[model samples]
Target: MNENKKPTLEICLTPDAVSFIDLTGKIAVIVDIFRATSCMVAGLASGVTHVVPVASVEDALSYKSEGYVTAGERNGEKVEGFDIGNSPFEHMEQEFKKIVMTTTNGTQAIEAVKNTAEQVVIAAFLNLKAVTSYLKSQNKDVVIVCAGWKSRFNAEDSLFAGALALKLKGDFWWEGDEILFSTHSYSSVKNNLSKILKHSSHYKRLKEHGVENDMDFCLEIDKFKNVPILKGNILENLAK
Candidate 1:
């Protein structure tokens, strides 16, 4: 393959940064390192039937009456009167037939790429390997879109994107600038694993709620082998 013509990998810090990447013909990987992607990996790996990601709390609530189990967080707390919070532990009780999940950043990021990628695959530290394997198999130009904290940049998500970028670096050519295409090595991602808990509102909130372990779980690399791909309104695993 010609060096200039090799398939490329482009990482974006947020969805707003690259709103023009046509999602119809390419794979879009969404990473919300704080917890949504982490919770997604745990939920799917634990056999929760299907996870339906919604952009708004109202949408999630509406789905609740339709037999959809609700799992959501606003700011960082579980939605009031909801079945589960954004934590993976909350969804481990049983196979969630249909979980309406929402969050401040992750959910919106998923929604942002709803019409962009040919398909949206959820990525986190837990499923990084799974996501990378799936992307390599597809052999298409890929975009790693990070769902940063609120609208501002966050280190954890960037590190996760970096990890993916590092994996995709050799096989796929990078299309964006060096900063987007390159990141600290996987070792760096591993080193900063604990920092996600130390530096983010999600960690602080979960710590306050006595769920510090969730952050540790989220930061672990390749703990899960499942890749949650956004299908229609629900997230389903791609057979590896």
Candidate 2:
């Protein structure tokens, strides 16, 4: 992020990989296409004030005392006792002014780089163009942090990183084989993104959890224009 010329773009495929990536002063776009980030984009675009992303259910539940509507999920299912699940559609409803949410993967990734990155933005296929545009405007070193399943690599998030990287092709200098690998991954399935992604592990896992319907909406591109940028652990729409 301290570079003088055009910024560099890098991809962190999983939370575990964050150890090697220097996010200092960089803009980290957190991608969790299956649901979490999709929900963040959807909620912010729909006029919700802020979405607070917490690392664990305990962290999320603690916010309840302050009147932040609580929402969360674990292993693809809504956590018991929470007011809502991690679904973009549920977020689209906009039942509350603010929310504190946690997810099995996405929130964990957000927590990973919150302290290191200069700015953390939530992203998904739902707001691909918005996120890409925002990053271009920032003109800072970019790290596309894919919230892989449980701190491990997952196809959907990497696919999202690929699509975003492809969009930012001329804006920033690309770095590492991870970016190359993701770009190829996205190009291979771009024509049939939804159909092909239906075979992904997280997709199949959500199906087993009875929330497979969320996948189609999550994959819908450019459905929103707002980019949710994290401010002190709370995400507020940056584009608005």
Candidate 3:
């Protein structure tokens, strides 16, 4: 296939992948929509400083004692001994710097394909336009891996992926049908974003946790001009 004809568009709705990404050949967009990526984007935009993605809560704790503000979640709750949990609002603090973060699903999904992809990027609804712009500039095949809750599928991640797909489909050819949830969900949200997440488990989780406002914040698009891409073990702000 020619450059335009190359089979380059693919969306992995869940982090469970049989093959790891070959970063030298493809760009991997990692989505951990139920707030890890959201928090990262928020932290950066809020001027919290650098974010370091870790594989475990223990790893984050190790960094905490070293002055890195620690953040993560397990089963949607903040870890018992961390300075912070996986919430964007929490990172808004001025003390935030070199955040070491892990989460049940988000971080694992990131670690899952970190070694395979040529470039690993973190994505969230908060920086949708920034991510879409970067994806447009790359000629390589694109794979969007949604960090679902545990090994199970969640509506929010796919919905965020759908938004990316809908915008990307006009420019890149897609590979699978199931991953199209992101595109479809994007459309649904566009039509009714306020009500789009009313029934989602993520929304329920937030409401139960008394953080409904953060959910509203996450659903907003293009709030920041900066996109965070993983470079080595840390997240770097991509140029606007």
lDDT of 2 by residue, 1-240 (tens): 335477999999998898998888888889998889999888888968999999888998999999988998988889999999988878877567889999999889999999999999888888889888888888889998999988889999999899999999987988899999999999999999989988888889889877777888898999888888888978998845
Q: Per-prediction TM-score, please?
A: 0.90, 0.96, 0.92
- By lDDT, is 2 or 3 better? 2
Estimate, for each residue in 1-240, the C-alpha lDDT of model 3 and write its tens digit.
Answer: 235765477878778862644445678888886788999888988876688888886778888667898788888888897888877889778767678898988888888878878888889988899888888887667888888878778888888888888777767877667656567656756768758677887778767887777788888888877788888888878865
Residue 102 of model 2: what lDDT? 92
Which sequence of candidate numbers ranks them by lDDT, best first?
Answer: 2, 3, 1
Q: Name model 1 segments beyond 4 Å from true.
A: 1-3, 178-182, 185-189, 195-197, 200-202
In candidate 1, what are the lDDT values of residues 61-99, reduced to their tens digit? 898678988887888788898888988777766757578
Best by lDDT: 2
Candidate 1 achieves a global lDDT of 0.78
Least accurate stretch of 10 residues (summed lDDT) in model 3? 17-26
In model 2, which regions exceed 4 Å deviation? 1-4
- Quick one: how many clashes does candidate 2 have? 0
For each predicted model, how many residue pairs clash, with residues at least 3 apart or on different chains?
Answer: 4, 0, 8
Candidate 3 residues lying further than 4 Å off, grouped into runs, are: 1-7, 18-24
